[model samples]
Structure formats: structure tokens, C-alpha cells
Target: MRRIGLQLASVLVLLALWAFVAAMRWVDPLYLPGPGAVWDAFVRANSCYPITEGAARKICGESNYYLWEHLVVSLQRIGVGVGLGALAGVVVGYLMGSSRLLMLLVNPYLNFLRALPPLGYIGLLVVWVGIGESSKYWLLFLAAFPPVVIATIQGVASVREDQLLAASSLGAGLRERVMTVILPSSLPYVVQGIRLATGFAWTTVVAAELNNGIPGIGGLAFQSGVQLQTALTIACILVIGLVAVALDQVIVWIGRALVPWQGKEV
Candidate 1:
């Protein structure tokens, strides 16, 4: 409760400061619009609709979409990418973690990728795949892939020698040992990885949507920036930040439910 109170107080103080700056004209409205302006921009974007007469353009934000449309598309793109990435990461991570030869073969490349930002490879992906939806999906997939793999690897590695020995002494085969011991023991790490991957995929959405991304919030932000609609851009950014927090919280809650043993200091 105390922590929540502090957080709320901090947000209020920031808002007050922002209002003060806007009221005092400390910055140009074009650069830093007032909170009220930003709120109005958000409302316009959210309620915007296209007239079905001529060209059918939206009244605010993106030329083609209202805020909800942008949000839905963004969510879909992130969901597909993260889902594929998480699936592939778990499989590859488990295989590599279980085999010394495979780990040696792949660890160097994984290390290289870990050192690079997910967006850094977007240019190459675009160049190879062209500026299409595939490139965006691949970019976001790469963004979400590595963290989970590394986490799974760490989890597998953290398995105690005694657990393995006990399983072996009980005449358990490799498959049984993995299913009963390694997999369960490593679940917490895999969940953490998924959470981390979600964050990474979401952050990379703007970059992914940079090419032909009309129906996404990232694209909305880009369009607003291009049109010098600073208030709308700020509004889009706020939406992105809030949604990301909400997503992370969701994953955290799911992790708590799925891996109840996690974080218990026993």
C-alpha cells in the first residue's frame, strides 16, 4: 500500500510539473503539448471514424485507422511473433541445454545475437524479405526468441546433480528424468523468459511496423511524428507504455499461477 501510494504521488507530481511547464509556455506546444491537449488528441484518435463518401480517411491519428484498430493490429502482430518465438526458443533451448555438442555448436551464435539489439537486424531482414509483413513478423520473432532460449538454458543448467542421480538410480531413462525432474525444475526460468520475451517483442513493434504498418499503434506514432502532431504522438506513446505494463503484469500473474514454487525462498 505504501509503495502504491508513493507511485501514485510520483505520477501526480509529474503531471503537475507537466501542467506547470505547459501553462508557463516553457516549451513549444508543437514539441511538448499540454496534458489536456494530449488527452484531447487521445480522445480524438479513439473516437475517430472514416466517412464512407470519397476517400474514406480517418479524422485523427493514422490516415486509415482509429486507435482501437491500431491497438488490435499491434496486439495481433506481437502475439503471433511472440508465440512462435517462445515455442521455437523452448525447443531449441532444451535440446541445446541437454546436449554438450549442440550447446557448443550454437552457443557462439547465441552469444553474438545476445550482444546485438533485436532491431539491429531489421535492415537485413527487410533487405532479404522485402518490406512486407513477413519481415515484421521475423523481426519481432527474433526480438522475442533469444531471451527465452537463454533462460531455458539457465534453468536446465541449474538442475541439481543429486536430482539427476536420484532419477538415474531409480532406473529412470533420459525422457522420464526430463519429464519428471528437469522440465519441472526449469519451468520457472522458462516462464521468466517468456515474460522477458514479451517485453522485447513489444518494444520492437515500432521498428517492425516502420514499413507499411498502417493498422498498428507504432505506425500511428510514426504517422503522427511525420505529420508534426506532437500531441497525438505523445498519446500513442502513452498508450504503448501503459499497454506494455499491463501485458507484463498479466505475464507475471500467469507465472505466479503456473509456477507456484517460483520465488518461494525455501
Candidate 2:
């Protein structure tokens, strides 16, 4: 309760500061619109008034899509991208962790990929995969992959040798030992990686949707910025920030549910 109260108070303070800045003209509205304007922009994006009183009252927001549609499109892409990236990363990570030669072969490339900014490869992806959903998926996939790979590697390395030996002494085969012990022990670390990878994927969203994004939050932000609709852009950013925080919390909950044994004194 105290933590929640403190957090709410901090947000209120920030909002009050923002309102004061906007009121005092500390910054031009062109660059940093007032919170009210931004909120109105958000409401416009989310709401539609009835065009006709008849049965066929067509609903329409200011933009081509409502906020939910934009959110859904972006989330769908991230969902698929993260799922694929995590699967591949776990496999490659396991192989590399188990074999010195594989680690020597793959680590440099992984690091190189990890170090790159999304913009650096956006052009290459566009050329190779075209300006389509495939390109976006690939971009997001690349963004999600390396963090998870690194996490899994660390997790694998952290596995206790004694546990493995105990399982071995119990006549357990390598597969059984891995399935029962190693995977469980490493799961918490992998969840942490997924959390990290999710943040990366969210950050890459604007880049991924650069070429062809219609109903996507990041794309909306980019398009609105280009149009000089700063309020709408800021509204889109608020949506992104809020949704990212929510998604991160959801992942945290999932990790707790899946790995309840984690962090407990055993």
C-alpha cells in the first residue's frame, strides 16, 4: 500500500509539473503540447461519434484505426516475433552452452547482432525482405533473439554440477536430467531474458513499421510526427509507454506463476 501510494503521488507530481510547464509556456505547444491537448488527441483516437441516428450508424475515429486496433496490430507482431525468437534463442543457447566449439562459432555473431541499432539494419531488411510484414517480423525477431540467447547461456552455465551428478547417479539419462532439472532451473533466467527481449522488441516497433504500418501504435506515432501533429504523436507515445509497462507486468506475473520456487530460501 505504501509503495502504491508513493508511486501514485510521484505520478501526480509529474503531471502537475507538466501542467504547470504547459500553462507557463515554458515550452512551445508546437513541440510539447499541453497534457489536455494530448489527452484530447488520445480520446479522439479511441472514440467515435455516431454519424447518423439510423440503425446503420457508422463509427469512425479521426484516424483510419481506433486505438485498440493499433495496439492489437503491434501486439500481434511482437507476440509472434518474441515467440519465434525465444524458441530459436533457447535452442542455440543450449547447444552453445553444452559445446565449446559451438560457443566459439556463434558468440561473435550474436554479439555483433546484439550491438546493432534497429535503424542500422532496417534498410538491409527492407532490401532483402521488402517493405512488408515479413520485414517487420524479421526485424522484431532479430531484436528479441540475442538477449534471450545470452540469458539462456548464463542460465545453463549456472546449473549446479552436483545436481547433474546426482541425477546421473540415479541412473537418469542425459535427456531426463536435462528435462527435469536443467530446464526448470534455467526457466527463471529465461523468463528474465524474455522480459528484456520484450522491451527490446517494443523499442524496435517504430523501426519495424517504418515502411508499411497502418494500424500500429508505433507507426501511428511516426506518421503523426511526420504530419506535425505533436499532440497525437505524444498521445501515441503515451499509449506505447502505458502498454509496455502493462505487458512487462504481465510477464512478471507469468514468471512468478511459472517459477514460484525462484528466489525462495531452499
Candidate 3:
């Protein structure tokens, strides 16, 4: 509760400072809209359909800004890509961690993929997959894949070999050994991986949307920036931050629910 209060106070302080600066005219409204102006714009933008037919009629109907329905498309793409990428990464990472031969064969390739930026593959992904959800998925996958993979790999590798050997000596099969020994040992790492990958997911989701000209928050932000709607742009940024924080909290809650043993001191 104290931590929450401190965080709320910090946010309020920042907002108050921003209001002061904007009121003092320390920054140009064209570049940095005043806090009051941003609040007004947000009210205007959210009060009505900011991406409605009327909005299009007001702001050039055929532009990228013309998309009012693409936000849902972007959300779906991110959901699919991030979900699959994280799952695959955890599975493959565990397989590699368990088998030395598999690690040797797959680790180099995984490292190679990790080294490359998502943008480096955008053109190829677009050419191969076209401009649909597949391309966006590929981009988002690239964003989330590495963190999960590395986390799982490190988690499994760090487990005590003695525990596995003890389970084996006790007549435990490979499945039993994994469930009783490997999984419990590596759950903390898996949680950490999920946390890291979520941040990647958020970033990659927005970047992919903007690059593909998909109709989403990122596209909205890009359009507002292009049109010099600084207030709306700031509002979009704030929205993104809030959404990311919400997602992080959700992930943390899941981790706690799944691994309550973590709460007990050893």
C-alpha cells in the first residue's frame, strides 16, 4: 500500500510539473502541447469516434488516418504472435537445456536469430508472407522469441543435476523427473522470461503496426505526429504506457498464482 501510494504521488508530481511547464509556455504547443490542451484533446478524441466516418470526412477520408477499425486487427495479430512465440520459445529452450546434442545444434541458430533486429527481416517477411497478419506476426514473434528462449534455457541449465539423478535413482521416469525436478527448479526463470517477453511484445506490436500501416494505436500515434496533433500524440503515448503497465501487472499476478511457493522464504 505504501509503495502504491508513492507511485501514485510520483505520477501526480510529474503531471503537476508538466502542467506548470505548459502553462509557463516553456515549450511550444506545436511540439509539446500543454497539459490542459492535451486533456481537452483527449476528451474530444475519446468523447466521440475519433476514427469515425465523420472524422475521416474531416481529416481526408483515404489517408492512413482513415482507419477506424484497424485497431482490432492489430490487437489480434499481436495476441496470436506473442502467444505462439512465447510458448514455442519455452518448449524449445527446455528441450535444448535437457539435451546437450540438441543445444549444440540449435543454440547457434537461435543466437543468430537473436542477433538480428526485427526490422532486418521486415522486408523478407513482407515479401514472403505479404502485408497481412502473418507479416505482423512474424515481426512480433521476433520481438518476443529471444527473451523466452534465453530465459528457459538459462533456467533449465541452472537446475541441480543431482536432483535429476536422485529422481532417476528413485525409479522416476523422464516425465516424472521433469515434473518433479526440472519444472519446479526453473519456474522462477520462466516467470522472469514471461515478464521480459511481454515488454518486447508491447514494443514489437506497436512497431509492427506502425510499419505495416496497420490500423492501431501505433498508427494513430504516427498519424497524429505527422499532422502535428501534439496533444493527441501525447495522449497516445500515455495510453500506451498505461496499457503496458497493466499488462505487466497481469503477468505478475499470473506468476504469483502459478508459483505461490515463491512467496515462502527458503
Candidate 4:
């Protein structure tokens, strides 16, 4: 409760500072819209719609903004891309961790790819796959895959040799050792990697949406920036942050449920 109070207090302080700055016009409203303006923009984006005529009249309420649609698309892309990337990363990482030769073979390529700026992959993906959903998914996957791989490798490598030896003495085969000892021991690190990958996936949404001019929160932010809709842009940014934080919290909860022994001092 005390920690929660402190967190709320900090947020309140920031909001107060922001309100003061906006009220005093210390910065141009064009660059930083006040909270009220952002709220108005949010309401408009969600509620405002256009009336239509003729046969399309019943369902023809078209608004310049479709916040929900954009949010759904972004979530779908992130979910699928991150899911695939994390699975592949865990598999490859387990293999690399288990085999020094495999690690040696793949490490150089992994390092090379990881060193590149994530957005740099966007152009290459566009050229290879064209501007389509495939390109977006590829970009997101690339954005998320490396960290998970690294984390999984580290996790697996950190497993105690004594545990493995004990399992072996207990008549455990390779598969049993992996299933009971290796996987459970490495799960914490795998979950950490997934958490990091999820952040990457969410951050990559803008670049992914830019590929085909797809309608997502990223597209909305890009359009708002292009049109100089400062309040709307800020609203979109706030929405993105909120969603990312919410998703991350969900991941954290899952981690706690799966690895209840994590963080306990030995």
C-alpha cells in the first residue's frame, strides 16, 4: 500500500507539472498538448463518426478515427509475431546452449544480426517480401527474436551440473533430464526473454504498420504526426504506453504463477 501510494504520488506530481507547463504556455501547444486537449482528442477519436446516405446509411457512420480497429490490429500483429519469435528463439537457444559446437557456429551470425538497428530490417523485409502482412510479421519477429535467443541460451547454460548429474544417476534419460531439470531450471530466464521480446514487438508496431500503410495505432500516430495533430498524437502515444504496460503486467503475472520459486534466496 505504501509503494502504491508513492507511485500514485509520483504520477500526480508529473501531472501537476505538466498542467502547470501547459497552463503557462511554457511550450507551444502544437508540440505538447494539455491533458484536457488529449482527452478531447481521445473522445473524438472514439466517438465521432460521419453520417452516410442511401443504402449504406445504416452502417455508414464513418469517422476519421477508428481507435479500436487500430488497437486490435496492432495487438494481433504483436501477439502472433512475438509468439512465433519466442518459440523459435527458445528452441534454437536450447540447442545452442546444449552444444558448444552449435553455439560456436551460430554465435557470429546471431551477433551480426543483433548489432543491426531493428528498423533497418524493415527495408530489407519490404524488398524480400513486399509491402504486406508478411513483411510486418517478419519485421516484428526479427525485432523480438534475438533477445529471447540470448536469454534462453544464458538460462540453459546456467543450470547446475550437479542437478544434471543427480538426474542422470536416478536413471533419467536425456529427454527426462531435459523435461524435468533443464526446462524447469531455464524457465525463469525464458520468461524474462519473453518479457523483453514483448516490449520489442510492441515498439516495432509503428515500423510494421508503416510497411503497407496499415491501420493500427502505429499508423494513427504516424498520421497524427504528419498532420500536426498534436493532441491526437499524444493521445495515441498514451494509449500505446498504457497497452504495453498492461500487457507486460500480464506477462509478469504469468511468470510469477509459473515460477513461484524464482527470486527466493537459496
RMSD of each: 2.7, 2.5, 3.6, 2.9
Better structure of 2 and 3 per lDDT: 2
| Per-residue C-alpha lDDT of model 4 across residues 1-266, encoded as one tens digit per residue | 99999999999999889988999999999998788898888877777433553443332111243687788888998988999999999999999999999999999999998788768778888899999888888888887889999999999998999999999999999999999889988999999999999998898898888755447899888878889999988988999999999999999999999999888632
Can you write out model 1's per-residue Cα lDDT over 3-70, one digit (the tens) per residue? 99999999999999999999999899889999999999888886765566465785654565779789
Q: Kindly provide the TM-score of model 3 when superposed on the true structure, using C-alpha atoms.
A: 0.86
TM-score of each: 0.93, 0.94, 0.86, 0.92
RMSD of model 3 against the true structure: 3.6
lDDT of 3 by residue, 53-114 (tens): 55644432224333334345556776777788889999998988888999999989989988
Q: How high is the lDDT of residue 231 in model 2?
A: 95
Residue by residue across 1-266, what tens digits does model 2's lDDT show?
A: 99999999999999899989999998999998889999998887888767766646766654668978988999999999998999999898888888999999989999999999989999999999898889889999999999999999998998888889999999999899899878988888999999999999998898888788877888888999999999999998888999999999999999999999998632
Clashes of 4: 0
Q: Which portions of model 1 show Cα errors greater than 4 Å?
A: 49-61, 264-266
> Model 4: runs farther than 4 Å from truth?
50-65, 264-266
Query: Which window of ten consecutive residues has the lowest lDDT sum in model 4?
Result: 56-65
Which residue segments of model 3 deviate by more than 4 Å? 49-74, 263-266
Better of 1 and 4 by TM-score: 1
Task: Report the Cα lDDT for residue 39, model 3.
Answer: 74
